[model samples]
Target: MKTYIHNFIAYKELLKELVQRDIRIKYRRSFLGMLWSVLNPLGMMIIMTLVFSHVFRAGIDNFPVYLMCGQVIFNFFNEATTMAMQSILGNAPLIRKVYLPKYLFPMSKVCSCFVNLLTSCIALALVVVVTRTPLTWKLVLFVFPILYVFLFSLGIGILLSAVVVTFRDLQHLYGVIITGLTYLTPIFYPIEILPGWVKTLVEMNPLTSFVEMFRDAVLYGVVPGMELHIRCIAACVVALVLGIWSFIKQQDTFILKV
Candidate 1:
């Protein structure tokens, strides 16, 4: 573990380069460029707010802010993990020639996505201000959920980066899983609208806890309960530990597979 830490620190510059490259590649040739990160969520929020706010009658105060919070959290996790799944195979030429720590590739992807997450938060803040959502000291606590979700996504990304190198089909299958997860996450809808069993399943989702914690701070203006804090921390730790363990165990064989 010490060696791994040493190598990661040693290659920190390379990681920064990779992260910058990702951000550049993402916006390259796009007319809107990075602004899309901010606009995309705001646009989606407008559309969903019109549709669900009336159709579902979500009844929550500041529905747009509620919706934006969920979108920002879930979108970060989705984008980070999806991009990380391709980190290994996408850089196969470099991997075949280089001696860099393989984990850095996926780590860089997650870091780049985090940059977008911050921009999306700007959109959320704009909506909060526009809708006149009350700002409270609890807004500071919003950072906790973001940090928890970042760690959780990093773990999932690392694990996927390793596994997808060999099971290339997983790249497609993961899209389906993400779509299913989106609906199960209560992004635009309230959990109370779900059937009891369905609500239980959604609550069990780690993303659910993170989303709720974020809403508690940013949308509802309440501090997240201790139970939520513990749940988010536990989920982040478990996912990260499992991701790192799997990556280490399988890294040796990656050369052969990739």
Candidate 2:
């Protein structure tokens, strides 16, 4: 851990460059540019609110606000994970030419997503205020959940960069998998809406706590469930360990594979 941290600190310039490259290239040819990032999620949330709130007759009051909270967070994860999948192979030139820390590629995208997520936070705060949601000091509890998000993203990004470099098809396969994972997640509905047995499975998913934690802080102003909190922490630790192990094991072969 110390070595990885030290390596990251040493290669901080590469990280910043990568982050800037992502922000620039992401919308470089587009008309709306970065606004599209803010709008896509917002537009999806609006459609969802119209469909789910009115059509499905979801019992969730303030479904717009509730759903937006989940959408914003999910978008962050989606962007981070998708970008991380290509982090290594996309930078093959740098990988071949440079001697910096290899992990910096994916972590840089995570940092870029971090900036995007911060912008979404401002959008989320506006939603909360416009919708007249209650506020309390408990909102400070968001720190813990956001930290988990960053760690969780780091863990997954590092692991995927290693795998995707070798199995290129994973780049396409993950898109399908993430689509399924999105619906399987309770971003649009409450846990109560799910079957009891299904809730057990959902609770086991680390994203469950992250989503719930967001809602708790932004909507209800309460702490997350203890059981889910424990599960979330455990999941993050396991994932982080696996990611680091995989990176260390597979990185030696990256040049040959790429």
Candidate 3:
């Protein structure tokens, strides 16, 4: 592990450049450039607020902020994993000619999406201010959920990048999966509206915990129970370990596959 850490550290500059390159390419032809990171989610929130706010009818005040909270977490995870899945095959030319750490390619993709997630948070904050939402000390605890989601997404990205190199079909499959998950998560609706079995299923979903945590901090302003925290931590750690292990095992043959 120390050897891997040292190697990654040695290639930190390469990783930074890869991340920067992705950010540039993402907005290369756009007029707003990075500003779209903020605008895109905000635009989605407006549409969601207009559509789902009436359909779901949650008692939660400031439904836009409530909805944006879920959007911020879900969108980050989706975007990060989607890009990471293509990272290896996308950079095949570089891998063929270079000696850089292979994992850095996917890691850089995750880092770049994280940068976008931060911008989306700015949009969320503006909504909070415009809605005149009350602030509480527990709002500071929002970082915990955000950190867990980051780790969880990073792990998933690593795993996907490793697998997608060989199973190119996963890219299409994951799009469907993410769309299903968005509805499974209580993004626009209250968990109480779910049937008991569905509620249990949602509770078991890792993203559910992160969404609930974000709602707890940003919307409810209460600290989540320790059990919830443990669950999120366990999910992140397990996914990360499995992802890293899978990548290390498969990376040896990636050159041939890509």
Candidate 4:
């Protein structure tokens, strides 16, 4: 762990360049650039709000805010892990010639998506202002959930980056998993509408804890309970420990594989 930390500090500048490269690649040839980050989730929120709030009648107050909260958290996880999964393969040429820590590649991807996450939160703030939702001191506590989700995503990204190098088929499999995960997460609808068993399953999802904690802070103006803090911390710890362990164990073989 000390060695890892030392290497990370030593190569911090390389990480910065990798993160900048990702942000540039993401916006390359795009007319709107970073504005799309703000607009994409906002647009999705508007469409879903129309369908669920009007058509299906989700019956939730400030549904746009509620929906955007989930989008901001879940979308970051999706983007971070997807990009990180490709980090090793995508930078194969560099990895071959360089002696830098392989973990930096996926770490940079997560950092880049974090920039997008912040911009998406701007969109969420706009919806809150437009909808006249009351802002409370609890809104400041939104940082806690964001931090929790960031760590969780980073751990998952690191784990996937290592595993995907060995099992290239995981790239395709993960897409299907992500699609299923989206519906399993209560983004557009309330959990109350689901049956008891389904509710328990949904609640079991780690993302559910992150999403609900975010909503409690930003949308509902409530500090997340102790249970949420415990769950989020546990998830973060387990993911990071497993991810780092796997990466360290397999990194020496990455050059041959990639």
What total of clashing residue pairs does each candidate reach?
A: 0, 0, 0, 0
Q: Look at candidate 3 and tell me the lDDT of residue 33.
A: 100
Candidate 3 Cα deviation (angstroms), residue 209 = 0.6
For model 3, the stretches where C-alpha displacement exceeds 4 angstroms are none
The C-alpha lDDT values of all candidates are 0.93, 0.82, 0.92, 0.93
Tens digits of per-residue lDDT, candidate 1, 70-186, equal 999999999999999899888888878877799999999999999999999999989998999989888999899999999999999999999897788998899899999999998
Candidate 4 lDDT (Cα, 0 to 1): 0.93
Candidate 2 vs 3: which has more lDDT: 3
Ranking by lDDT: 4, 1, 3, 2
Per-residue lDDT over 1-258 for candidate 3, one digit per residue giving the tens place of the 0 to 100 score: 998999988999988999999999999999999999999999999999999888776566679998999999999999999999899999999899978789999999999999999899899999999989888999999999999999999999999999998899998899999998988887888888889999998888899899999989987889999999999999999999999999999998999999
lDDT of candidate 2 over 161-188, digit per residue (tens): 9999888899889999889778767888
Q: For each candidate, give its TM-score against the true structure.
A: 0.98, 0.93, 0.97, 0.98
* lDDT score for residue 3 of model 3: 89
Q: Compare candidates 3 and 4 on lDDT and give the better one.
A: 4
Report the error of model 1 at residue 27, Å.
Answer: 0.6
**Could you give candidate 4's per-residue lDDT for residues 37-101 as a string of tens digits?**
99999899988887778744646888889888999999999999999999999999999997989
